[model samples]
Target: MNILITGASRGLGLALADESLKRGHSVIAAVRSPEHGGKLAELRERYGANVETAMFDVTDETAIARFAAGYAARGKRLEAIINNAAILTERGSSIEELDMTEVARTFDVNVLGPMRVVKHLLPLMDGTGGVIVNISSEAGSLHGAYGGDYAYGTSKTALNMFTEQLKHAVKPRGIAVYAVHPGWMKTDMGGSEAPGDPRTSASGILDLIERRTAPSRRFSFVDYSGSAMDI
Candidate 1:
C-alpha cells in the first residue's frame, strides 16, 4: 500500500513511516522542512525507493493543494493518509489565562489542517478505496476531560467532530475515517518521562488500520490497541 504520513520529521510520525517501510509498504513522508527532516532523511537513506519525502506545512492550504495536484499529476494514489501533524502550544494554561492567539494557531494546525488534507486529497483517492487516520488525543474527549491545555484539547475536540462527520460523508465511497489516540509516547510532545514508545504505539496503530474493515459508531474515538475510547 502507498501511505502518506504528515509530520514525518520526528516522533510518532517518523516512527509510523519507519514501521510502514519495514512492512514493505511505500511511504510518502510529508515534513514541514525537507532540508531539516532528520529522521525522515534517515528513512530515505535506509529504505531507498520505498520512502519518498514531500515538503509542505499541514496548515498551508495552498501547499497541501499543490501536493495533491502534484501527486495526481504523477498518477499516484495514496491508499492511506495519517494526519499526524499537530502542535501543543499553551500546554499548561487554564481557560482564563489561555492565549486566544495560540488557540487560533492550534486550531489552524490540528483542526483545519486535517480537513484541508482530506478535502484536497479525496479527489486523488477517487475510485480507489483508502483510510484516513486523524491523530487525535484522549484530552479531546468531553467525557474524559479533566485538565489544562485548553487550546490543545479544544482543537482536538474540533478534529474529532471533523473525523466523525467525515466518516459519515465518505463511507459510501469505501473510505474509512478514524480518529485515533496514539497513546502517551516518549516523544518531544509526550516528553521524556512518557512510558509508551513510539514504535510500539505506531505498530499497534498500523495493525488496527490494516485490520479495520468498516466504520461504526463504536469506533469514532479509539486507541492504538483497537479499544474504543470516550468521545
Candidate 2:
C-alpha cells in the first residue's frame, strides 16, 4: 500500500514507517523540514527508493495543498495518511500557572494542524477508499481522570470531535477516519516515564489499520493494543 505519514522523522511515526518498509510498502514520509528530517532521509537511503519524502509542516496548509497537487500530477495516490504530528505544552507546568503562549502553540501544532491536513487531504481521498488515522491521545478522553494535560488534552478532545465529523463526511466517500490513542510510548512526546515503546505501538496500529473490516460511526477511544476504551 502507498502511505503518507506527516511526522515520520521521529518516534512513533518513524517506527511505523520502518515497520511498513520492512513489510514492503511504498511510504511517503512528510517532514517539516527536508534537511532536518534526518531519519527519513536515512530510511530513503536504506530502502533504496521504496521510501520517498516531501517537505511538509501540517500547520502550513497552502504548502501541503501545493504538495498534494504535485503528487496527484505524478499519479501518487495514498492508501492512508497518518496524521501524527503534534506537540505537548504542559510537559512540566500546572495548568493554572502554565504560560498562555505555550497553550496556544500546542493548539497550533496538535489541533489546528490536523484540521488543516484534513481540509486538504480529505478531498484527495474522495472516492479513493483511503484510511485516515489521527494520532490522538487517551488523555483526550473527557470521561477519564483528567489531571495536568492542560492544552494537550483540550487540543486532543477537539481533534477527537474533528475525527468524528471527518468520519461522518468521508464514510460515504469511501474513506475511513479513526482517532487512535497510541499509548504512552517512549518518544520525545511520551518522554522517559512512558511504559510503552514506539515499536510496540506502531505494530499494533499497523495491524488495526490492516485488519479493520466494517465501517461505523466510531468516535472511538482505542489503545495501541487495539482495545476499545470507554469513550
Output the worst ten-in-a-row residue range by lDDT, candidate 2. Answer: 212-221
Query: Please, what is the whole-model Cα lDDT of each candidate in the order they appear?
Result: 0.87, 0.81
Q: Please give the clash total of every predicted structure, in order.
A: 0, 0
Error of 1 at 103 (Å): 0.5
lDDT of 2 by residue, 192-230 (tens): 999998998888777766655333335555676667755
Least accurate stretch of 10 residues (summed lDDT) in model 1? Answer: 211-220
Query: Each model's TM-score, in the order given?
Result: 0.95, 0.92
Tens digit of lDDT per residue, candidate 1, span 1-231?
A: 889999988899999999999998999888887574877767788889998888889888899999889999998998889999999999888778988999999999999999988889888777777888999999899999977868899899999999989989988988888899999999999999999999998898788667643334555788887678887
Best by lDDT: 1
RMSDs, each prediction?
1.5, 1.9
**Count of clashing pairs, candidate 1:** 0
List where candidate 1 sits over 4 angstroms from the true fold: 212-219
